[model samples]
Target: MLLPQALKKGDTIGIITPSSPAPVLFKARYERGLSQLERMGFKIKEGKCSKQTQSYRSASIQERSEEINDFIHDQEVRGIISTIGGMNSNSLLPYLDYAHLKKHPKVIMGYSDVTALLLGIYAKTGLTTFYGPAVVPSFGEYPEMLPKGKEYFEDVIQLRKKAPYVLDVPQEWTEEMLDWNTQDRQKQMVKNTGWKSLREGSATGKLIGGNLNTMSGFMSSAFFPDLEGVILFLEDSFKDIATQERSLSMLKISGVFDKIAGLIIGKHEHFNHLNAPFSIEDLLFEIMGETNIPILTNVDIGHTFPSHVFPIGIKVKLDANQGTIEFLENSVSE
Candidate 1:
């Protein structure tokens, strides 16, 4: 797998609005996010779509794709991060300058709807992409980015720490929501109950996956990465039991369960059980139909605060019996 150069203190990070017009909709929070990045000692270059808005999305598909392509050709930009995630990032896939990105690789990171881009880029170029925090919901949080989330980002992208290490579960986490425009303080956090080992086993394979619902947009396309022997991680937010069934069934029907080595499920933000008598775990087992792969759930990753930064295509060891996840190698090069 291709690794991007490790980001340094003074490197420029290009910010693009591939889908949502968040910078315009939440101007105050958006500026705060940029301020936080500046405080981290990184230069910020706002792409054309950063300030543009056409109702739901920042711009048209052509404009959105061009914004990313512009950053791909920019020599000074060492990384690109989404301002926020929305529904149509999949629309930008076909128009991206994948060949240019493959030749001049850089760190590309975001979560939620941006999963389409992360997995798509990794599939197209074999360059590792990040499934982590985005500007608005994460970095733009009232006072600043959550400390653990910041550390994970720096550790992976900025190379503050090396890999071949186990990931730490934050002692506390939050899924509380506050209106961004009128928020005054931090969201209320609760003690982490810890990861659950749904199955007792272990496996090591390449790590690949992101927001479970977002995968539906491109799962059938060439953009989706191969699942063969991969330790797949999936997470979603505000989804009901029915939605969960459909999404899980998509993978089941696609032969994903047969191909993957292990599964890591991140903490679902504001999940709606739909008053089902069965839990999501029970539903998952029903859909999986007796696959014996190791499965770990309630791990901290995705929409929740202080989430871990997962580098797509990196080698990882998943020990479901012990509820541990370890990165087997560094995700970025010096």
Candidate 2:
């Protein structure tokens, strides 16, 4: 895998709205996110799409692709982070300049609907992309970004922390939502239950996966990578059990379960069971059938506060029996 150079103090981090026009939609929060990055000692460059909103998305596919490619070609931009995730990032895939990105390797990171971009870039270029915070919902968090969220970002991108480390179970987390435009307080966090082991055992493999719903957009395309021996981690927000069953069944039919070395199910944010007779885990087991890959669920990642960043192509050791994940190697180069 092509590891991007680690972000350093004063390095410019370019921000783009490949999906949502969060800057226009939530001006105050968006600017706060930029200010937070500035306070962290990095320069910021706003992509053209940041200011352009078309109802649900930032701009046309052509425009969004151009915005991201602009950062890719800019020699001074050390990293690229999404403003927010929306529903249409996959539309920009064919238009993305993968060759240019390959030649100019750098950090490209985000989650939610932007999973299309993160995993797409990794699949095309063998460049490790981050599945972590987007500016508005994460860094722009009111009062200040959550310390744990900021620390996780610093751990991976800035090397503020290092690898050969086991991820800490955050003592608290939140999925509480407020109107982004009128919000003024930090999210209310509750005691975290931490990770749970669904099946007991251990396995190690390159880490891959993001929002399960987002994968449907680009799955099996040239943008989706081979999942053989992958430690697949996925999560979602507001999805009901029926939808989850269909998605999981999609993966099952595609033989993803047979290929993966293990599975990590992240804590679902505001999940609805829809009055189903079975729990989400029961649904998962129904779809998984008899596959015996070590299964770990309720991990503190994706759509939840105090989330951890996962690099797309990094070797990871997942001991599901112990409910732990350890990065075996640093995901970025200096």
Candidate 3:
């Protein structure tokens, strides 16, 4: 995977609404995010379609695709960030000029629906992208950026270091809102409980995988990555245990589990098994039994607050037994 240059303090960060129009529904928070970037010594560039809203998409597919292409082609923009995630980002894939993106790669970060873009971009150009918080979720809310979000964001873009990094749980986690209009809200702190190991073992490979639903959607697509030698990280929100099992079963059928070197299960929020009468643990163990690769569950990296930001297309060594991940190489350009 190509490591884009690490962002400097004064570098320009382009903000685009590739899926949903965040500025339309969260105008105040969007502005707050922009202000936060400025305060952090980074220049912010808004995409032309950032505020445009359509029936189910943030903007017309053409417009959103163009905005992303333009940002990637802009020499002054050191990195790119999506405002938020939404359904239908896949529609913009055909319009994306992968050849152009390959010529001028940069840091592209977002999560949830943005998973499509992250994996698509990686498959097309071999560029490392981040699956983490967005502007609204990370920067624009009542309180300032979530501490873990901010720390991981800085670690990936500014620290320019490799991982094998130990995951720390936050002392506190919050789903409540602070007063966004109040200046002091930015200083309010949230705590976390740190990362916990579900299965104990050590394994390493290229880190791949994202929202299970999103990855499932791309199963037959040309953009799906070569799963061999990959440590698959999977997570989702609002999905029942049955659905989760179905998705994992699909992966198993497609030889995804068989191809990967390891598996990392991130936090699955709001997941409940239906009347199917089976526990999530039972489903996971059943599906994972197909592969002998080291499997780690609940690594604290998805659909939850205070998640870690790691390169999706880079090599990673996961020691579930030790509760740690080590990177064999740096994730950014020097």
Which digits, one per residue and each the tens of the lDDT, describe model 3 over residues 155-262?
777764454465555666644445544435544344554445666677878988888888766666888888888888888888887778788889888878778887
Instruction: Candidate 2: list runs displaced more than 4 Å.
Output: none
For each candidate, the alpha-carbon lDDT, in order, equals 0.94, 0.92, 0.78
Better of 1 and 2 by lDDT: 1
- lDDT tens digits, residues 149-223, model 1? 899999899888898899998999999989999999989989999999999899999999999999988997999
Q: Of 1 and 3, which scores higher on TM-score?
A: 1
* TM-score attained by model 3: 0.91
Model 1 clash pairs are none
Q: TM-score, each model?
A: 0.99, 0.99, 0.91
How high a TM-score does candidate 1 get? 0.99
What is the Å distance of residue 65 in model 1 from its true position? 0.3
> Considering summed lDDT, which 10 consecutive residues are worst modelled in model 1?
155-164
**Sort order, lDDT high to low:** 1, 2, 3
Question: Per-residue lDDT for 1-334 in model 2, tens only?
Answer: 8989999889999999998788998999999999999999999999999989899999998999999999999999999999889899999988888999999899999999999998889999999999998889899999889999999999999876677889899999999989988887777889997789999999999999999999998898998999999999999999988899989998999999999999999999999888988888888888899999888999988899989998999999999878899998788997
